[model samples]
Target: MTATAVQRFYRYHAYVYDFTRWTILRGRGQAVEQLKLRPDAQVLEVGCGTGLNFSQLLARLDPRRGWLTGLDFSEDMLARARRRVAAHGWSNVSLVCADAARMDLGRRFDGILFAYSLTMIPDWLAALERARTHLEPGGRMVVLDFGRFERWGPLGALARGWLRLNHVETRRPYVETMGSLFDRVEVHGRLGGYWFTAVGSNT
Candidate 1:
């Protein structure tokens, strides 16, 4: 699928995303922990839908010293994030609507996160490369995404197929691509390959 198609997919999903995603999207808080953020760090979250992870991210950040930039391809999704940010009166959080694979914000971040967003990106390798360029040396990047259910037997295929119909491709070599880009990488899979987390540290 193309970037435009992905944006279209989120147009409607954005409305129901916050309410319905809890069923399948798990381990988000733990993934944010992998970032190991400092109170004054500059963080970037790619595809931060509805800003669902903002509370966890912001909890680790000092609004007076730290800042967050949330990027998404769909304005509909961003609109939801904007409301969430405004409702909480979070001044340090900002949202941008742009394609992850092609965005060049001309700056780097201390901690970069791709939570459940990487697998949905069509040019996922490009997105990872772009994210690497936007990461500071010694900074860390965290990827929490759907994993290939390597051991789930028939259920694995069913899960993968269902996710594909929703425009999320799980078979891509996402972890391998990150291994090639970062200085050091560690990966962990959860619940029989239901999801995975990759922490890439740039040395």
Candidate 2:
């Protein structure tokens, strides 16, 4: 999609972005917990909309040590995120507008996260690969998103339908595909069958 189109899609939702989506998307805290960063670790969050997860990360992080960076394609979302970061005086944090599928930041990170963002991205596989490139060796990457319902039993279909209403869907081939790059890949779900989390580390 054109930058304008992506902007238009998120612009209208930027104001109520966190509230509207938080109710349904789970696994964020778990995703953050899985990062397991070291003191002074460089961390990057992809598709960081409105700084929702950033706030959580900041709260759990020691600003005196680790560094945090957030990137998104939407200007509207980044604007709100900037306000949040500034309001909290989070000097350790930085925000940028870069496409998840294409970024040349000239740096690597110890941890990378995509919290409930893969499905909404148009070229998610490329984004995953790009994230892999940004990871330091032995670095961990985490993902949380709408999940496959097949394992959710009878309610699976209904849960997927609910996600569809919000323009989100699970990427089924995520683990099988990402395994080729990351030495280890584990994908799991929660929220009564609504969301998923994947963790991977480069060999």
Candidate 3:
């Protein structure tokens, strides 16, 4: 999809996004926990829809010693996210409405996350590469999204079909592309084996 189309689609859905979809989604907290950030590390979350996972991340980082930044292409989404940040009274957080594929935060992050956001991006590979570029040395990128179901049976088809209906398309080439940039990649699945979480580190 073109950037305009993507932005429009998300803008229309931003308000109801969390309420409509949070139940089905899984692995976000696990992905955050696996980042293994030090107290002083800086973190960024691309496509931080509604900032649903911000509280989880905050628990892992000390406010006085750590910082967090969230970037998204949709202004509507950023607005809602900012509201959540304000309600939570967090001062160490920042939000930017920008294309993750071309964002220049002017500093590298100790960790980054792409939670349930890659499938919606038209140029996801470019965004992943940008995530790599934004990382400090030894930094890790934690990704959680729908994955191709390798299990056999009629249920797998049903699951894939359900995701397709929502405009979600999981790509397996992500592993190959990530392997080229990251020294180590670990992938795991959850939720009756339909969802996946991947952690890639610069090493």
Candidate 4:
């Protein structure tokens, strides 16, 4: 989807995003925990829709000592995220409305995360490359997204079609791409291979 389409889509969905996504969007908390963020680490969350992962991230990385930046292309989504930040009193959390593929924050980060966002990106490879450039040496990058079903049966086909309707390209080789870009990469399948979590590092 183009940025405009995504924005318009979220304009309506943003209202119930947190509540609705909680059941289907799995592994986000695990992905954040896997980052193993340091107390003073600088972290970036690409496509951080509605700030769903903020609580988990803030729990792991103290706001007094660490900083978190959440970036998303949809203004509607970021609007909800802004509310989340304020409600939680996360003074150290920042939200930016911009294209993640081309965003340049004028600084690198100790850790970066993409939760259920890569498949929605048309130029996912470019976004991955850009994320690599934004990571400081030894920085970690974590991804949690839909993957091809391990068993492509009738149920798998139905699931794939349903996800496609939601603007998710489940066939994308997210793990393979991350493995190619990062020196050290670890991946784990989840939800019967319908989803996956990957952790990579720039050593």
Best by TM-score: 1
Comparison by lDDT, 2 against 3, better one: 3
| Model 2 pairs in collision | none
- What is the C-alpha lDDT profile of model 4 across 1-203, one tens digit per residue? 67577678788999889888878888877899888899899999999999989888888777788999999999889988999899888899999988888988899999999999988887888889998899999999999998788676788888888988888888877888888998899998976877888999966
How do the residues 1-203 of candidate 3 rate in per-residue lDDT, one tens digit apiece? 57777788777888798798777788777899889988888999999878988998888888999999989988988899999999989999999888977878788999999988887777888899888999998899988888777673787777777776566766447767777889999888775557888889975
Clashes of each: 0, 0, 0, 0
**Candidate 2 off by > 4 Å:** 1-4, 151-155
**Which candidate model has the greater lDDT, 1 or 2?**
1
The candidate 1 region of ten consecutive residues with least summed lDDT is 6-15
Local distance difference test, each candidate: 0.94, 0.82, 0.84, 0.88
Each model's TM-score, in the order given?
0.98, 0.90, 0.93, 0.96
| Model 3, position 199: C-alpha lDDT score | 89
**Order of models, best TM-score first:** 1, 4, 3, 2
Ranking by lDDT: 1, 4, 3, 2
**Whole-structure CA lDDT of model 2:** 0.82
Each candidate: RMSD: 0.7, 2.1, 1.6, 1.1
Residue pairs in steric clash, candidate 3? none
lDDT tens digits by residue: candidate 1, 1-203? 88889888888888899889999999999999999999999999999989999999999999999999999989999999999999999999989889999989999999999999999999898899999999999999999999999899999999999999999999999999889998899999999899999999976
